[model samples]
Target: MLELVVHPRVSARHPQLSDEDVRVAWQNSFFQALRTGSKNSPEYLWIGIDGKGREIEMVGVPTATGYLIYHANTPLSKRVRDEVKGRRT
Candidate 1:
């Protein structure tokens, strides 16, 4: 008998990420923007795209700056938070 270890899917369409996947992607892109210093818009409103190239903005951002957009539930958020917290220690 062969054992097959099933792993959770990590794609954008994965079921687990149905609600937060796009938000996470946008957050990642926002971080890239911040890293590159492209500050035309400091805030990142969430967005979604259909297969036909239609884009729908999900949320709104009144004001923001830097990589803070990826905070809370994002992967980059923890690293960024730790880095900032470390500076004060």
Candidate 2:
């Protein structure tokens, strides 16, 4: 099981999402890639569907024990969605 540690800032930034929503998104991730231009620790970007069936974009960094999710939001940009779709094909 992948342990997910959601940062407190996530709620502040996206109050509409709950911990459960974040968990669901992680579990259902369809696209994930290591973010480019990271300075320190490696950061990852993920796109997944939540329990509500809403597409969510998540950003996080891997920790010693698990992933620390620092950001999550819905309605991903068309460019990003298209990029992911292109990669899938």
Candidate 3:
């Protein structure tokens, strides 16, 4: 499996998702994107992925350096918030 390449911006903004979460999310998203990604776009391999519980949203954009996945959001709560940042309660 290829190592997940998460953008620094994603890490800084969404601390709820650890590096491991990023890895799993990327893998699941990438594979699913492959089945559903559009190939006609001019941009380099642009794709989008979302976690099952809607915890995070990702958008993959190709760059000269390499592939980069940016997490748009890391939602930690709904009508309620808790001390355990990683879990949804």
Instruction: Give the best candidate by TM-score.
Output: 2
What TM-score does candidate 2 get on C-alpha atoms?
0.83
lDDT string for model 1 (1-89, tens) is 22211123322324433334444344333222122232534433333442333332222223323222222222334445464455448
User: Which residue segments of model 1 deviate by more than 4 Å?
Assistant: 1-15, 20-40, 44-60, 63-78, 83-89
Show where candidate 3 strays beyond 4 Å: 1-3, 30-54, 63-66, 76-89
Q: Rank the candidates by TM-score, best first.
A: 2, 3, 1
What's the TM-score of every candidate structure? 0.20, 0.83, 0.46
Instruction: Compare the candidates by lDDT and give the number of the best one.
Output: 2
- Candidate 1: TM-score? 0.20
- Pick the winner on lDDT between candidates 1 and 3: 3
lDDT of 1 at 70: 27
Q: Looking at model 1, how many pairs of residues clash?
A: 0
Candidate ranking under lDDT, highest first, comes to 2, 3, 1
Better structure of 1 and 2 per TM-score:
2
lDDT of 3: 0.48
Candidate 2 lDDT over residue span 1-89, tens digit each: 66899888888888998888988998999889886766735988899999899998888999878899988887786766786777678
